[model samples]
Target: MSKKILITDDALFMRVTLKNILVANGYEVVGEATNGQEAVDKYDAHQPDLVLMDITMPIMDGITATRTIKGKHPAANVVMCTAMGQKNMVIEAIQAGAKDFIVKPFQPERVLESIKKLIG
Candidate 1:
């Protein structure tokens, strides 16, 4: 079966772009969130196999969201979305239990590769 994934990003464009990438590659886009809090809610609601989360958002940030999800479901797989030069935040997210991360201006290949590596 195709892996189920949740996508979380504040930008509608980014979400749409990622949804297209994941769907075209055969991964199920189980849900989408515009912020970290929503991501957490959707995570619980959908129980997706993996999450693609943005680092910066209006509500809770991705690192906090990652931590929240991981705290509840220790096995939850979260992939943080980072902007260029946010190395420190990326490290924090990793410490919070994120599986991996994709830099913004996302490359479709890398996104799929990260998800595949984490869930497959």
Candidate 2:
């Protein structure tokens, strides 16, 4: 079965792009969120196999959401999405229990590789 994935990004374009990439690569996008709080709620609702979460967002940030999700589901697979130069936040995201990260302007191959590494 295709792995179910949740995508979270404040930008609609980013979410669409990532969804396209995941869908094309044989992953199922189960849910999407524009902020970290919604990401967490969706995560709980869907219990997807993976989450691709943007580091910066309104309402809540990725690191906090990652931490919250990890606290509840220690085995949750999360991959942080970050823009160029957010090194500190990236590191914090890893510490918060994200399994890996993908930098934006996403390359489709990279996105697939990250998801495959975690879910496959």
Each prediction's RMSD over C-alphas, in Å, is: 0.7, 0.6
lDDT of all predictions: 0.94, 0.95
Weakest lDDT window of 10 consecutive positions for candidate 1: 111-120
Collision count for each candidate, in order:
0, 0
Give the per-residue lDDT digits (tens) of candidate 1, residues 9-88. 99999999999999898999999999999999999999999999999998899999999999999999999999999999
Instruction: Point to the candidate with the largest TM-score.
Output: 2
- State TM-scores per candidate: 0.97, 0.98
* Off by more than 4 A, model 2: none
lDDT of 1: 0.94
**Model 2 shows how many backbone clashes?**
0
